[model samples]
Target chain A: MQKQVEIIKANGEREFFDEGKLRASLLRAGAEDSQVEAVLRHISKELEDGMTTDHIYRHAFSVLKDVQNPRAIRRYSLRRALIDLGPTGFPFERFLAKLFASQGFEVKNDQILQGRCVPHEVDLVAYNENKLVMVESKFHNRMGEKSDVKVALYVKARFDDLSEQLFDYGKARPLDEGWLVTNTKFTENAIKFGVCAGLKMVGWNYPEKGSMRDLIEDSRLHPVTCLPSLTKEERELLLNNDMVLCSQILDSQSKLIELGIKREKVTTIAAEAEALCGR
Target chain B: MQKQVEIIKANGEREFFDEGKLRASLLRAGAEDSQVEAVLRHISKELEDGMTTDHIYRHAFSVLKDVQNPRAIRRYSLRRALIDLGPTGFPFERFLAKLFASQGFEVKNDQILQGRCVPHEVDLVAYNENKLVMVESKFHNRMGEKSDVKVALYVKARFDDLSEQLFDYGKARPLDEGWLVTNTKFTENAIKFGVCAGLKMVGWNYPEKGSMRDLIEDSRLHPVTCLPSLTKEERELLLNNDMVLCSQILDSQSKLIELGIKREKVTTIAAEAEALCGR
Candidate 1:
């Protein structure tokens, strides 16, 4: 019998190697079926007696970078890329507002407004021609961390306070809805509480088919943080300049050059952005 | 040499029992100096090796209840008594508003207003001749629990949201300040954060002599739950009828009788309320 393989986790717990989880992650990143299978089989043979998941991840990542499709590898690291986009959540907030902008919403982030009790800092506020939404983002840098029910309650409670004033003395129409967005997942209880409280949750893989991943995938409004070709300093330069999306990079190619992206790389980035936006 | 006595803490840690800590607590509850020393001595004798903190609490509580001054005993149990004031926090909200009312503020509790992002439920909103303030209450059932920095941050963030609307589109006048009120105490970090953020904090013994206890004692606007004369059913009855403060019972004597407080008890309750409310 083949030896049972053990993989170490971030918290130092050891568990059996989970190929299904890896396969699902690859699929989410836009990996083709054949490539994914070949990569997995290659890693299966390379497994050490007690290798860490980090090592396994690096092995897979190298395979991805070396493989012909850089786009699929970019998509695979999207969650990590989202985390790397932030030391604080300010950059992520800008990225999300820009994503909404791509979807034809006039969006604002980090807006302050009066609630009945106290004032609140809204992470993102979006208004279409018809509806306005208040969004709160619960960001975590860790992979398995979740936004729990307390956060859901907190958001809904604040929303309830603010909505009362909105109806009584609001400038425009009362807000149509409130939203809670997270870079990671929502706890089951959070989802349950959010639904009961009438707050929408946009999280990775949450609500299955219409998750944040699906929304971004459909819109093709990928954040600048997700671009594989851009150097770290170059990405930060664009983010600092308030150009959050790959589309923003294309629109402001000269700005990217000013931020020290070489012209050839800028051309490649534009091609990638165009390819991403096309589908 | 007298053996050093160890007392268990709420979190199940044990430390040397210090009479100064006990004396400070007794003094805070308005216990006379002699009575405080005697009570501490008695508890010191009764304590055995490895006695649990809950056991120590019950012993001390019994001593407080039996000693001469019922009012002082009421002050000692103020935190616990406040917890019993709620089926939810609705009655406590009313009670807090009435306390503010005694301070010459026209106060409203549980009001909903539109914030910039969503509607929020304000616990208490007070308007005096000079200023308007928004208040948030943090109530804890446990004796040692505190309103920590996260709660402070939460309150300040919410206040920032509300104040934005006050600047942009407020009617009459914008709020003058925000205050966080709690039945127990604020953590040191909470106090530090509040001070830096310019949000006022009130709790049992925070802010030195000007604590929540000081405010309550000064105003004599005690919650009906603080009255030992009333049965639990009667307290709940008064709470449900929106008669949260002791003064409310005196103002509505007929309502107390309607809730089945006998005519004699009604007279006693009225006298106590009057005595409590006196300048």
Candidate 2:
């Protein structure tokens, strides 16, 4: 019989280390069976009582990096790269706008639309011929932070205010849907309020289907920050230039050259981005 | 004619320094006409362009302190003392609870009551025979920080949730009214939404007639931190023991004695508190 080791989560809850869960996640990241087993063995050996899940994640990421699996590393680093878009959260909003635009919706960012009671500066507004959606992106820079019910309560109120107000998006139309999107998880109560109020919510791993991760994966719209070949400064420069996706880098190699990267290095970086995004 | 000097406000707005406004505020704080003139002379001599209103305030506070008017000093420092109660804002909540309790309302702090769709941890709940009020205290430690429209919108939603939900507060009753209280100011849009939504609001200097300052002055429920005689550490010690009001010190002299304060110092502090609160 093996002794189960308890590990602390990012939100400070304790649970037994589930080797099966780790194996499944690695496999989902497209790791080979041998690579998955090796990673699990390494994690088990390093496991200790009262260790944090954040530490375990960093350890697993490092092992994957050492195994030279660029695609797996890119997939594993998706959530963290989203967090790197913040401190101001403006980049995350732009990222979401681009993500939606790729999905065949016309998107606008930082729009000040009049509500029934007052005006609101909505983060992202996406519309098609069929539907117009208003979104509020709740960005958290820290790892363990979750958007609580108070946020949902306020977002629902904002949505309610804009529900009957006509806005000119090609034509005068009322808001068909409202969304509260986050780069992190939503608290359980937040999800409950969102559901009860009929306000659509999209979190990092929430709703089981059509989550933020699912949308990004489905559209192959991984952010430029997910590229291992680019340094932090390079990624920030790209984001500042309004280039969010790896596909954007492939389209505009001149952005890299303008940032003072050598021709050979730019080619190498674009090659990695191409492979990561399956371009 | 003296040239009007433009000074920066805490919120970055530039305005001409108004001597009449300064004189009126000093008189309102109980300064004598002579003291007010003396302070005005000092301020005029030291005035410069582009100086911040915050700098003007500190200079005025120092000049008032030098005049050795204890009551006037306590009253002048009242707004600042409320700001010093924060960082966490819990003390501000407790302080508001104490203020409501003084006004013949049975008050409860930090109550988790069931709402229509979810539960909310209300800051203060106050009730009497005729009216039951749910109060949310928006505390901002930073100077010039205001509760924006988003805060008002969310608070209205929370109040709407608890409107029809019956709760046992001595007896089964639904909420009668909802109040938003802040130790600072509310944005203009917030006030607009609050008025339109019929959510009662109280801010430091809002509503003109029944603001937070008026309530505090009416009840003479000055926080212990307003006393210039007590050192910062002593004030914090008193507050940590749940002694919120200066009047509380007069009733419980043993609390001061237990903190190892000398008999004469305790007498001096209490006398200042007594003079400040008129108890």
Among these predictions, the greatest TM-score belongs to 2
Q: Model 1, range A44-124, lDDT digits (tens) per residue?
A: 889886787656764664564455476555556677777867777888888788778777888877888676655677898
True contacts kept of each: 0.00, 0.83
Candidate topping DockQ: 2
Which runs in model 1 stand beyond 4 Å of their true positions? A1-75, A167-171, A275-279, B1-279
Model 1 local distance difference test score = 0.70
Single out the weakest 10-residue window by summed lDDT for candidate 1 chain A.
A164-173
Chain A, candidate 1, TM-score of 0.70
Tens digits of lDDT, candidate 2, A112-175 = 9998889999999999999999999999997699999989989988888888889999789999
DockQ of each: 0.05, 0.58
Q: lDDT of each model, Cα atoms only?
A: 0.70, 0.81
TM-score of chain B of each: 0.69, 0.74
What TM-score number comes out for model 2?
Answer: 0.76
Instruction: Highest lDDT: give the candidate number.
Output: 2
